[model samples]
Target: MQTLSELGLAVAQRRRALGMTQIDVAKRAGVASDTLSRFELGKATDFGARKLLAVLAVLGMEMQYSLEGHAGSLESLAREHGLRR
Candidate 1:
């Protein structure tokens, strides 16, 4: 998840899950197939922000943030019901 390839693969998987081709998404995002391919293939270390956002928009995805220690990283949310580690 920290690498380009991992992110690209995830995006590719989700796009495929939606039954869309690379061309379809690229066109929708107003980008070239090659650009999307690099993203899907995990070759691009820095996928352009605007273009990446566009692709995410096409796929109904977005970037969000969460605070660590405030909420559980995995199994539970810390401080919920006074839970403590």
Candidate 2:
């Protein structure tokens, strides 16, 4: 997603879809449950890349990168094309 908040929401959705608990994921990812909770709530300000990768790994997810203009906020993309949400 284009923003940390969006990413957090996506992670929460994925975790729920997999029937996983925040505590379980935190334990498996080697991070504190509080940290995981903050992250899932889009309230984490200092979550490092390594920890993020670890969490993603535990969730069977991976990050993907694309050229700058190829991927952006859905709202921005829609606006650019004069489309409605």
Candidate 3:
């Protein structure tokens, strides 16, 4: 499982690889550049999921879910924790 910092790094690397600046991504994602900077820095305080998703969409990425090792299905985990998927 990648930590928030790792994920942030990956996003930053991908953006750089595509020759896109932070400002470009911010404009494309409809977010402020400072917010995007915080995300790239792995601040992880209160990043809105929808905002992150929008940013990722601009970077040609989408969120997906999967089990962690042999942790069983996500449905089972959600049921155990009273979470809805």
Q: In TM-score terms, which candidate is top?
A: 2
Per-model TM-score, in order, reads 0.74, 0.79, 0.74
RMSD of each: 3.8, 4.4, 7.6
lDDT of 1 by residue, 1-85 (tens): 5566776787898899999999999999998989899889877766888988899899998876556546445436544656687
Q: List the candidate 3 regions with Cα displacement exceeding 4 Å.
A: 70-85
Q: Which stretches of candidate 1 lie over 4 Å from their true place?
A: 67-85
lDDT of 2: 0.88
Worst 10 residues of 2 by lDDT: 1-10
Candidate 2 root-mean-square deviation in Å: 4.4
> Candidate 1 versus the native: TM-score?
0.74
> Residue 56 deviation, candidate 2, in Å?
0.8
Local accuracy by lDDT, each model = 0.83, 0.88, 0.86
Model 2 residue runs over 4 Å out of place are: 71-85
Ranking by lDDT: 2, 3, 1
Residue 82 CA error for candidate 2 (Å)? 10
